[model samples]
Target: MILPIVAYGAQILRAEAKDITPDYPDLKELLESMWETMYYSQGVGIAAPQVNKPIRIFLVDTAQVFERMDDEEKEEYDDDPGIKRVFINAHVQSLDGDEWAYNEGCLSIPKIREDVLRPEEITLSYVDENFEPHTETFSGLTARVIQHEYDHIDGKLFIDYLKPLRRKLLKAKLDDISKGKVSVDYKMTFPK
Candidate 1:
């Protein structure tokens, strides 16, 4: 099932998501639906809040990103082999290394992309889809994707990192998105 992504201005998108226990209703089913929705929407990552679910869950798949890179680029990012993972109740233990800028986008804020600066590496601890605990560090593009999704669960948007002037310039577009005035290929639930 492809869930309707909650668009910008949706109350849920601004609310901090709660952690879900292993027994959360239909956990398996919800994850599956999220993945389907993500792929259908051509998104590398999706968070529970994007689907109107206030739970700490997000998925990331970087295979497409890896595939698009040339041989030289792949060599530079050798450690990143298109990781695909589900993070539940995730917490960033630490972030290290110099900050780099990456163009980021979100399913909830469709058609909006901006250069957002973030740390080059991060140490994260989270439970997997099966509720198994894992702590790991990520870098490069993978880390960037994870950080973007992590923000969603924390009630943060990439645009929030932009300069005030840039945000102001995008005000009309943002308002259009909230009112379902923008065109998006994927289904979205705009604010009422």
Candidate 2:
């Protein structure tokens, strides 16, 4: 089932998510629905908070535009559907110092976009859906997506990266969003 995605300005999106332990049976089904909802929303990544579930879970599909690739030149890795990765109780082990800025948008934030600087590479330790532990290094867009989704577990948002002036400007719009005074068009365009 495709779960309803919580939009931007939703308080749950900004709340810290609780960690799901290794022995949970519901973890399997939740991960499955998250992947389904992500595909339905045409988003490469989805955090648990985005689905109104404040758990330390996230899904990623990074077969698209990479951070180092030119926006116009990059293409989706293949015609095949993306491989779904379920990261549970994840922790960043290490990361490269080099950073890159990318214009990122969030499902919660509607049409808002902003340049957020993030590590270009990182090593992470996480448990997969099978309860097996694994550690792997990731770079480029994959690294950014990992960090972005990881932050959700800690109650962070892409909007937190905005400069003070930018945040000030967006305050009113955010207010309207949370109050349901404004509506968001969910149509999303993904890179080919």
Instruction: Name the candidate that leads on TM-score.
Output: 1
The sequence of per-residue lDDT tens digits that candidate 1 reaches over residues 9-115 is: 99888899999999999999999999999999999999999998999999999887898888888886635577889999999999998998988888888888999
- Cα lDDT of all candidates, in order? 0.92, 0.75
Could you tell me the TM-score of candidate 2?
Answer: 0.83
TM-score of each: 0.97, 0.83
Q: Model 1, 51: alpha-carbon shift in Å?
A: 0.5
The alpha-carbon deviation from the true structure for residue 22 of candidate 2, after best TM-score superposition, in angstroms, is: 3.3
- The alpha-carbon lDDT assigned to residue 29 of candidate 1 equals 94
